[model samples]
Target: MGSGVLCIAESAGNELKKSAFELAGVGQRLAGALGGPISGALVGEGISGLVEGLGKRGLPKVYVVDDAALGRYTSDGYAIALKAVVQAADPAVILLASSAMGKDLGPALAARLGCGIISDAIALEVVDGKVHATRPVFAGKAQLEVEPADLPVVVSVRPNVFEPAASGDGAAETVAVDADLTGEQIRVVVKELLEPEERTIDLTEADIIVSGGRGLKGPEHFHLIEELAAVLGGVVGASRAVVDAGWRPHTEQVGQTGKTVSPKLYVACGISGAIQHLAGMSSSKCIVAVNKDPEAPVFKVADYGIVGDVFEVLPELIKAVKEKKGL
Candidate 1:
């Protein structure tokens, strides 16, 4: 049987993403239980510089797939490159971050390797020498533990749920793998990349998020949400209702249908906390809800709840945060 864990490291704009370290943390834990070495797979163009950082996070060895054709993420291109590393390393388990790219890449890579995959796993443990995964089910209403029936299964871990491993003074040994990719192999060609007008932290990786819902009544009042987020140095989030009503962009939506976030602090302003919305952020370390309704469902899942109008309460909360930071 194969042994050890391999982390599928991801990067953007040549910089290592926070999820890369988070994946390393998960790999280290699983590798310790399996009593095997932990390695990493780094794919992309000119990403050799990131190998040293992964080593400091406990991955002493990494397989790199570097080529000019992989300047952007393409499902077919990445899957083909990763297949080569998987063949060389033959890890017992593969771990990936459940981000947008991972959500797409995980299934493709698993299909290529003809292995079973568990997506959006919140926790992993070794049971009787086999890797068992725990993931949310039924819209975060319950938890389910699954064990793959075969060896070398793939798992996509929820972002921010695992603590990022601390970096150490270590370097990694890199094995270069050729990314034998061609334009004909990639069915989809990304003509251009459109950057968001406002460059903010990805919701899944944000430490703090301030989300607004329809209770704000209109898009004109979303400034309240933006101001609070700015004061706390957090990303802005929105509920499905807000997005559907054109009050916020779909990218900012936080729900089962939107981005799943587990930030350090989640502030819900004017949100009633639908089950779908809760499913996305229920894992947040601390949740603070503000609404006029005394029995809003948001309070049920919140660490703290304010039973008052957001218009009246948000200013005070923002003021308190500013004072605390002496801003």
Candidate 2:
């Protein structure tokens, strides 16, 4: 059997991502069940500054690989650095967030390590010294449990599913390592990092989401959703139909074909709640539906339902929210 659990930490702008702390909590639990210490690996430029924070987040040891070449995320460079950490740690299981970087790096790293991987895991546990991961399958309609056939199993966890671990009193031991990657080994080079024009909380990371659909009428009417989202301090989401109709960008789509979000509150405005759309947000803690059609499928799952037109209802709702919050 392999030794402890090693969580791969992801960072943006030299700050640790929320998923990193979630993975730390997961690693700590797995290590307890497997009878070993919890450790973490951070790969990026100037990552030493993050070591102290990771230490207090319950990791006993952190493997740091700070290199200039790793300043921008390239699949080859990150894979090479993570490979070095895995070799030294010899962990029984590896946990990563199912973010863009993790989705790209997890497979490559697993292939390099010659291990099987369970992607987008929502739940993890150790049963009889083996890691068992539960994930959505068949378009999020079913749940599947996976167990790796060999040691050093790799698992990528979905964002927002797990709570981040609280910080501890003591600091973790930092281990500096070298990836020994050559220019020739890095087959792909990153030329630039393009950012979105308007940055908001990612759907997977947001606690509350206000979504709209065709009932809102036109592309210009998305402002209603945006205004409500702003009032609630939440992000704006849209149904796939709106996206397909060119009313909204695909980034804001929430459905089987788009990003799955598990927020604390999901307010569906003018949405009929198709199964594909429900597949994405049915996991939300509370759902509020506002639609003219009382028999809409969305009402079946909604905690609160209002049978009314979105345009007339939205203005009143926004005003109510503002008054309630004294905003």
Candidate 3:
């Protein structure tokens, strides 16, 4: 069994995603525990420039596959390219960020390699030279510690749960691997990539998240939530009820069926803490809940609770935050 750790680095428009460094950090720790070196896998079109950044994150060797066919992400294309890297590195452990792409690609790559896969891991440890992952279960009501009964295992870690590796000045040797992707292999092709006109911090990656629930009354009043998030230099999040009502996009929803977040601070406004909603943000470092109902479920887990109308409380809270920032 190969003892090395291979980090699957993610990138966007020539820039490496923060989760890439996070994976590198975990990869370094895992490699040290296994008494092996850490390497990286970079896959995409024109992403060779990112190899140095991976090296700064402590990876000594990086395998890259730069091909025009990989200009846009496809489940099959990335899986095939990454499989080539896996064969070249012969790593025992593979680490990936549990982003949209990772969630889709991890399983496919595991299937091709015939290895066990663990997704959305919040904590990871090396016990007895095997990776042990701790994950939330039963809608965050319970925790489970699991390990794949195999050497070559693929683990997708939740975003923001782990700290990124400290940058260094080291150089990494680049290994260019051929991407053997045939048109027949990719049954589905992405014709175009549509990006949001105004990009906001991704909810999963945000350090602070201000979320709203049904108590906001209507969609038009979401400006309060937005203003507060802006003041806090955070991102806006929504409850499933808000998304279901078309008050917000599904991307902003935070719950069991939506995105799981573990921000440094999470503020819930007008949200009655449904179990599913709590399941997502309960892991946050600090939770502040504002609801008219004093006994709202959200308050049970909140570090601070405000029993008042969201409409009245939000404005004052925003004002206080602005004053604190001297804005």
Candidate 4:
């Protein structure tokens, strides 16, 4: 296995994304399996410092493409730059995080490089001398194994799914390159970015998540949910109905249209667990549901189910948790 691994790094808000480092950890393992070194690639404006973070995760070389034109993300420009680096590196496997930017850039790079692409790949391994990718199919109801019969297999790994590997004394060798494409040459324009709330932990990154739904009755009821989240050291999430009702922001929604999370534990209160909602959080390691309706779908996949009014059950649950922790 002479093929090396290339892990793409994503940075924003001056912090190296955990997904980037975790995917590199995966790439490191894959590279070792293939008897080669794993390298990381980062492209953006004034992003040279992000290499130290990647380097600690066992990444040897970090390719940087710094250009003012790349200050804001554009699929066409990023795709062009990544394709150039990937071509130059000639790695057999390329890994990217499943962020919004990644979803746009990864496929564009694959198309530019004329390679088969697999998106939202949860698990990856070598199969028959090729990359075997496992991804959700039929809208997360089933899994599909994708075997790309091409060079440089492109895979997008979901956030928080792979934990970042422990650090080593790995130092980064920076490889500088030009943007290679101009802004005038690109077709799309990004006027603004509606950033998410910074103080709250992103649902995809939360180790523990407590979600609320219609049972909460009104937007003000989210206070209880937030209180419980604060106690559990977790994030507060909402179902689609609550979001559409304007009780919660769309960024806090957890469903097929929103972010997917595979946390160590997911506590759903009042949510009836619509199919779309389950599609997003079903992969959670453990689920706890509290609902008045005994027939709610949330209990079907729940490891622990409590049939009672959410208002009554949530307070009790919070009290029990606090007492357990001596808080």
Candidate 5:
């Protein structure tokens, strides 16, 4: 049953999310490793031409579930549509981003297909024609290796850890599948998505993130964090303490209870790297910890460390980056 791998394309604002490319890269590589073809599945309105971009990212086939029912995300609609396509494609491996949407639907789809599902994977490999996944367990304290015994192994992955992939010479070939709605009534109808107080880059997809904590002192000083983020073309993030204290918006909080981040550079300002906080960003490529306390757990994982007050250090760091880039 080793057919191929399919990554569900996700939208970032109006276009394809970077994580889509990352998964396409994974799918393409896995297909090559298994001597199979790489394919993708697209579900949404007005995304016909979107498959062209997917083809350029190494997808040979783009299965489109084009219908009015797919205009908005309804759990049942998505599960039904995806189930139809996957059953038609007969794929042995399916990949999805470990984001809110993927997390919401992966398990439901897995249950529908009667297959094993793995989520929030940090690493994946196809060995001897079998998919093996590694993911954090016990809140980032340890990791577990999961080898599904089912033919169609469903995987949801952390974004940004996989290397960014460039365009390829592949062409998009469309495949049509009949829609089904077996669980449509059982799914909750989402009325609306909450309007973010300040819509910034999603923590999961940010290239650079500057996060603050209780050490930022108060809500008024978050402006400093925002200013630094502006200087660096990064997003300002915060710990749960800061968000719970109303010092910053909950949208900016990065922790187990909030959004998970895997940026190229995750600069922790005044954060002590609580396990809950580490669970969100421990997968980042490069970590920099800036805090007054020298022995903070954040420093242990930091590639670069600055043992100083964030208030005193942040301005200097911003000035240096600006000067270094001649901003």
Candidate 6:
């Protein structure tokens, strides 16, 4: 029988990603409920520095597969490496973050192991000695509770949904494993990586997000949104309408057809909240809506509503934030 919970840790530039910590916390809870220890699996090159931190964050055991070929992310290489870890650990439950890497790896790994997988899970718990997961469905319109049908179940959790586990005094026992993957096994190779010039926090991982809509008038007015987000130390987001208008990139668009974000504070500027837009950010902890239209749909879900023009309100908000921060 499978035993314990194993969390697949993801990293970038040799540092653990935020999703890794979140999934670790999820794994910790599942392990506690199952009365078993939680372990972590890291697959990358020169990632030994991350192992100690993972251990401190309540993981008693951490499996490391540091290979030069695994430095850059590829589906086959990562999948094969993770397969080796799963075989060694023999975990009852496998948890991964619902990031790009996790989404790709979770299903592939599950297919290889012949186990049921729950993807984009927002919540997980042990009910009646079985793992039960809650995830958004129907384009974020509703949520469904699911239980994996097979042993050694796999789950990919949504990023930023779960709080990270706190640090502890216990040191993690590190175990290095050999995947022994050959050149032919890795079909896809990354030729070049082109990063964006202005690096902003990922929308899925940002704590505070300030989003704009068509009310901004044109693409040139986006500076108003950017300025406010800068003062608040938050990322800038956009409605699908503006994205469709070519005012902003699709990467910044938030809606049923775009990325889903659950930030701590979501500020909607000039947005007339369509259901599709709300589907993406309705799960935010606190929503502040600013719009000229008093009855805008976004105001319905906002914790605080401001019936004012974004151009007029944004400058004042930015000034207040700067003053408060002594910037």
Which digits, one per residue and each the tens of the lDDT, describe model 2 over residues 245-312? 99988889998888888888999999999989998888788999999998999998899999999999
Report lDDT (Cα) of residue 266, candidate 5.
Answer: 88
User: For candidate 4, lDDT tens digit of each residue in 79-171?
Assistant: 878887887677888999988788888889998888878898888887665678888877678999888777678899888777687778878
User: Global lDDT for candidate 6?
Assistant: 0.89
lDDT for every model? 0.92, 0.91, 0.93, 0.86, 0.86, 0.89
Over 1-327, each residue of candidate 6 has an lDDT whose tens digit, in order, gives 787899998887667888888878888888989988789999988987899888878888999888999888888888899899999999999999878778888998998788889998988999999999999887677899999777798899888889988878768888999999899999988778888777779999999999999999999999999998888889999999999999998889987888888899999998899999998898889999999999898999999999998889999999999999999
Give the winner by lDDT: 3
lDDT of 5 by residue, 49-87 (tens): 788889898888888887776777877888888998898
Alpha carbon lDDT of residue 216, candidate 5?
Answer: 93
Model 2 TM-score? 0.94
Query: Which residue pairs in candidate 1 have backbone atoms (N, alpha carbon, C) closer than 3 angstroms, thus clashing?
Result: none
Q: What is the TM-score of each predicted model, taking all chains together?
A: 0.97, 0.94, 0.97, 0.95, 0.96, 0.94
Worst 10 contiguous positions by lDDT, candidate 1: 182-191
Q: In model 3, how large is the Cα lDDT of residue 4?
A: 82
Candidate 4 matches the true fold with a TM-score of 0.95
lDDT of 6 at 196: 75
Model 3: residue 269 alpha-carbon error in angstroms? 0.6
Q: Could you tell me which residue pairs clash in candidate 6? A: none
By TM-score, the better pick of 1 and 5 is: 1
lDDT tens digits by residue: candidate 1, 1-327 = 678999999898778899999999989999999998899999988999999989999899999998887878889989999999999888999999999999999999999999999999998899898899999999999999999999899999999999888989978999998767877988876679989898888999999999999889899998989999999999899999989988788899999999999999999999999999999999999999999998889999999999999889998988998999999
Model 5: residues with Cα > 4 Å off, grouped in runs: 181-186
Local distance difference test, candidate 4 = 0.86
**Cα-lDDT of candidate 2:** 0.91
